[model samples]
Target: MMGVAAAVFALTVGAQAPAEGSDQKRRLIEQKIRLVDTLINSPAARGAAEGQEAGSRALIRQGTQAIDDARKALADSRYDDAARLADDALRAVSSASRRMSPGEGALPESAQRKNLQDLGDQVAMYRNSIEELSRDAQKGSAAKTLLGHVDGLAAESRQLADAGRVGEAGKRMAEAYKLAVEELSRLRAGQEVLLSLKFDTPADEYAYEKKRFASNEIMVDMMVAEGRAIGDKRHLVDGFVEEGRRLGVQADEHAAAGQHAEAVRLMEQASAQLIRALQSMGVPVF
Candidate 1:
């Protein structure tokens, strides 16, 4: 009886040793995960994204996803999975944090000067376009005034560029360029200006997108029936159809999830892809 009891005690102790060791491992992994979370939300993670804002934001998104997975693994006591995921999260968040550091990666003086010059030229071109648009037959007083404002902005941008203030010049030129583009878009707000479309709600916009999508689909079908889609053109048109179909499905999924704005955006893109197919089939899109 004593020997049997002793054996049972030894087995119980061995089981407890592994459990305790696992608990310690779990704590350490959790600590690392918490630190990653904190780093992702810190000031450093919010700052650095000037020219590479999109890239920085994408890294942060990836890190966040990894962190979520790490937590899920930890919940299931998958220590190895939890650790690996936490490491991935740590790497992505660290990269994003570095990217967020303000003024850490300044371009050389020559590069800055070149960028400013390019931006200045774009601003000047946009100003010229606005000037030409103002001469159009149906332009209103409001349109002329908008054009005048853009011209003034372009002038200011040029002045800053001449003064050798690269950063200020770039910013002013970028603003002028954006305003000029908006003015042009507004003046040309019609069938081709998709972004200029107005809708009472995202749902209405989504519906319009669906109609546009269907129109494009029918156009492609007609092109096929007329034997327009042949040779390399057939292959190109098919690629567009596949991409449009994929995007349309994603749009529907977003719609089902109540993300109507995203759904509308995706549907619009899907329609645009199909329109490209029509254009490739010898039909003018715009």
Candidate 2:
């Protein structure tokens, strides 16, 4: 009776253990899936996803080149050096992925700057990881082959990371940031130029006035987009005020050109245009 009872207990315990193990695996898989989803949806991930399909051939070419390099390094018995290079190559691939990710596009300037800095840090981390592995690679032929495979993977990763959809997305984000900075600089420059100009003649004043008006229009559009992205109401209001000032300047320019009646018409028109644009944006432009 004792022996029979012990067997029954042991079997029951074994069955319950398997069930618990299965549950644990399911939970782990779910967590991993969530992590993957977050990475895929990231701006950098989006950029990376964009060109990957079309850039597969280029990535293959890069991988091939890297393999050739590794083969030469191995022949020369620079095993550790080859390993480091291979690791660096792998990091390039990772960088490419980051560059390609689409979600990076919507990032604000401060956020985007941090992203680039973080990528540089990640590269450093990969270098350290690779160096640690290189120690084992020096021990034997099997380790060399393993290292070689890792090298190939790194090469391929570097190749595909950028050439794929993400490269173009990275370019767009870079351009957007550049344009924003340029626009902001232009506004500052225009302000300085306006203040410094010696408008001794009407023609000189007219040119300066026209230039200022044009600059103001550009600033308005840029700031509108920038403000929306950064959620900055102050930038939006400042843009509106600049627009108003532009109209007033244009009216003065017309009067300087000996067209008082036209000046009056323009002044009224400018006010209406500014009001309409501001109102549409839900701004109180009074």
lDDT of 1 by residue, 169-280 (tens): 6556555555665566567666243334568988877876765665455445545656887766665665566456557767877888989999999998888877777767
- lDDT against the true structure, per candidate, is 0.63, 0.40
lDDT of 2 by residue, 80-105 (tens): 44444443333333233323332334
Off by over 4 Å in 2: 1-195, 228-253, 256-286
Candidate 1 TM-score, true structure as reference: 0.34
TM-scores of all models? 0.34, 0.22
| Model 1: CA > 4 A from native | 1-105, 191-286
lDDT of 2 at 222: 38
